[model samples]
Every structure is written in structure tokens, then in C-alpha cells.
Target: MEHQTIKRIAAFSDGGQGGNPAGVLIAETLPGEAEMQRIAAEVGYSETAFLAPHEDGWRVRYFAPEIEVPFCGHATIAAGAALAEQFGGGRYRLYLNNGDISVEGEIQQSLAAASLQSPPTRSEPVPEALLAEALALFGWHESDLDTRLPPAMAYGGASHLILPVRHRATLKAMQYDQAQGKALMEAHGITTFCLVHAESPTRFHARNPFAIGGVYEDPATGAAAAALGGYLRDRQWPHHGEVEIIQGEDMGARSLLRIQISDQPGGSIRVSGTARTIS
Candidate 1:
């Protein structure tokens, strides 16, 4: 039997040390669902995006090491960079199973920078029981949480629980059991728990426990970053208008993500970062 092949790329990093890695599989036609899942597991990244030619542009599907996801932002960025490298810097439209989205890539000063527009976003208040469980899992007390941000389940492309902590130290010391956390996330239908600490009006720090993706943590999460921007917009958080997210510091893999938001309500937000080839 011929095994399907896929390419791997790291997204949202300057030199590939601090970005979320994803597998980009481009094939004449997508294999069976089981085969895709098997390949994703073998690749062992947070998520793998598979692309196939379609009528409009490309039909895309994202699969984590464990399961298929509705959408994935970091992988989308990687896919965009991959496309730009192969075809030239330009915009690409993607049709996901859930909705339509777009990504753009360009060469800026000899570096590859890509941006992705997330799907429509929405948020819901976090339940008391769920909050308590999450705090226990991370060994954080209620006092550690930021009262201003208020915990909520936010979704742009995928669902994530956004919990703002009061202290940067609390955000830095993130830990959880893989099995237990995965069970909790699956039970709650969440992709990851986004733990954050605000550094300034426009800058923030983030840590994501992507247990559902069969990974202990994500170095950088574009989908969660987009969701975070939408959440802040909904609450009208004070900022310089642009949000900067710094992630993966605790893991020794530092990454940076920039989000641009508009004044319009429910407007699509842009997430941008630089990507370098891993090979």
C-alpha cells in the first residue's frame, strides 16, 4: 500500500523556533477520512490542514492529531504561506466544512508574512461549575482570575474558553494533566482553554492548553488569538485599537501574533504574523 505524503510547516514565527507547527497535505484528491486521521496522527502536530483543488479555490479540512476540527487558524496561516511559496504572494480563498474564509500572504523585507480572516465570532458566559473545574485543573484560585475580563467561551473559527488572569506569574505557571484536561475539553466541546494575562492596554500574554488536540500546549494559536480579539471587541476593551499577543514564552518558544480589529460590529478581524520554513 502507498502511504499518503504531507508537508510540514511552522506558522507565526520569525525563524521557526516559536511558532505552532502544522502539517500541510496537498493531494490530487483527499483520501478517506480514516486515512487523513491516520496521517495527522503520524505527523504529530497540533493540527494538519489538507487541501484539494475545488471549483472556487481549495477545499480545506483540518485534523488534529486526535480528531477533525471545524477550522484551524495557525494551519490556515501555514497553508497560506505554503501556497505563496509555491504560487507567489497572493490571496487565497478556502472553503471549510463550516464556512468560508480567506488568507493572504506577502513577502515583507524577504520574510514571509501571512494573515487570515476568521469566521464570524460569538461569545457566551462561562458557567460557574466549569470555571471551578478549570481553575482546579490549572491549580489556580479564583483570586488569580481577572474580574474585568470575565471568563467566557469565545468562538471565531473554533471554540475556546478565554480566562484572563490577574497576574502574569499565574499565566506563566500553566500545567494540567493531559488525559484529564482532554476529557474536560471534550466534555465541554472546547478546542482549548486560553489562559491570558494583560501586559498593557494593547499587549497581552497567552498560554493555550490544547488537550483536545492531543498536544500538551500550543506555542502559538492563531484561532484562539482571533477569538480573543473578537471577545475584546464585544466587551469594548480599551486598547490602542490593535492587539498584540505574545505566546509560548513559558515553553521557551516565544511567538508573536498581531490582530487588527475594526469599529464595525461583528466585523471580520485580521490575524497576522511572520512564518519561516522549517526545513
Candidate 2:
């Protein structure tokens, strides 16, 4: 049996204390799908990222405890940090199962700073039936939704249901039955439910229920965040070209993610954050 070493790193850390943890494996070649799946389950984190050198950059893949995801923001950030530590600071291209992206990383003040250019984004209005089912799962009323950002099926790299609440309290009170939510998400091809509140034009709070990936919640989700940025762009929300997201505070992880949005519709969003070793 062949085994590859994995590094545990947390991305989007708040002052080196809290962030979403991910496992990063970099080797000459990626492991077989079954082996990678087994490793991800054994690691038991929200996600694990694997990397191997490709034509001009690296091939990347992300896996959760139970299944694979199209793209994972935190895991990519962790991988970028790991690559920076090993090969020095620079921008690197990443080839994924469905797309290509780039990551820029550097070590600054003993922390890894990385930015990932997300896949192009698009959003669609949420179906009424799906919206109703989601509301029931979270015990929220339609009135609780923020009219500023209507619910949508948003996709940056992977798909997510973006539900913006009118109040921060509603966002904080998010809860759902894991099994039921998982079934609903899988049935609808949703990666997670990105429940959020707009604190201001430039600041937002988010909670992600990642039932499809077999996690109850994600402290920080870059893909969802990017999707939100793009969705806001589509809705003509006054984002002012940039936004900051504070997530996972309720779970004590306190992750922070910064995003830069472009004007072009379906443009790529740049998601950046600091990372540190879990250690």
C-alpha cells in the first residue's frame, strides 16, 4: 500500500486562532479515487485537498468525508499555503475535475496569505417549492428572507442555495436536521445552503450547512462566498466592488474571508484569506 503525507492547515483564520481546517496532500502524483476517499473519511475534516504537478501548474481535487466536491475554497487556500511553504511564494494554476483556477500565496508575518480566483459565477432564482422546503428545514419563514438579495441557486464552482436573511439573528439561529437536509441538498444538486445576512454594503455574515458533504456546518466556505459575491453583483446590490465576510463565529471558528468582485456578469471572484498550521 502507498501512503502520502498530509498536512493539516486551517484557512481563513481569524488572527491565527480560528478557521476551517483542511487536509492538504501534495505529491508527484495523485492517489487513486478510492484511496483518496478513504483518506478523506479518515481525516474527518470538512474537506481534504490533493495536488500533483501538471503541465504548467498543479492538478487539484477536493473530497469531503463522504463525497467529492467540484471545487473547495478553504481546501484550495490550504493547498496554496502548503505550496507556498514548499516552493516559495508565487501564483499557481490549478486544474480541477471541471475547471481551471489560480491561487496566489505568500508567507507573511508567519501566516500564509492566499487568494484564489474562483470559477466564473452564475445564479438563478430559487424555485418556489425548493424555497419552501428549505424554509421548513431551517424553521424560517419566507418573511425572514432579505428582500435585498432574493434566494437563488448560485454557482461559483459548485452549486449552493443562497438564502439571505433580513436579520443577523435569523442567520445565527440557523439549524436543520442533517439527514433530511442532506437528502434535499443531494436531490437538488446543492453543495451547501449558504444562509447569510448583509450587515452592510461591504460586510456580510454567513452560515453554511454542508449536508451534501456530510458536515453539519462549515465555519468558512470560499466557494459559497464567491457565489454570493457574484449573486450580489447580478442583483445590483451596492457591493462597491468588494466585500468582507465574517463566518463561523457562532461555531467559535471565527473565519474571515475577503472578496473582490468584478463588474462583468459571471466574472470570476477573487477570494482571499490568511491560513495557519493547525498544530
Per-model TM against the reference? 0.95, 0.98
For all candidates in order, the CA lDDT equals: 0.87, 0.94
Clashing pairs in 2: none
The 10-residue segment of model 2 with minimum total lDDT is 1-10
Candidate 2: regions farther than 4 A off: 1-4
For 1-279, candidate 2 gives per-residue lDDT tens digits of: 234479999999997789999999998999999998999999999999999999999999999999999999999999999999999999999999997999999998779999999999999999999999999999999899998789999999999999999999888778899999999998999998999999999999999999889899999999999999899889989999999999999999999999999999999999999999877
Off by more than 4 A, model 1: 1-5, 108-110
lDDT of residue 135 for candidate 2: 98
Deviation in angstroms for 67 in model 1?
Answer: 0.4
Report the C-alpha lDDT of model 1 over 67-116, residue by residue, as the tens digit: 99998888999899888877789999999998799999876554578999
Instruction: Report model 1's TM-score to 2 decimal places.
Output: 0.95
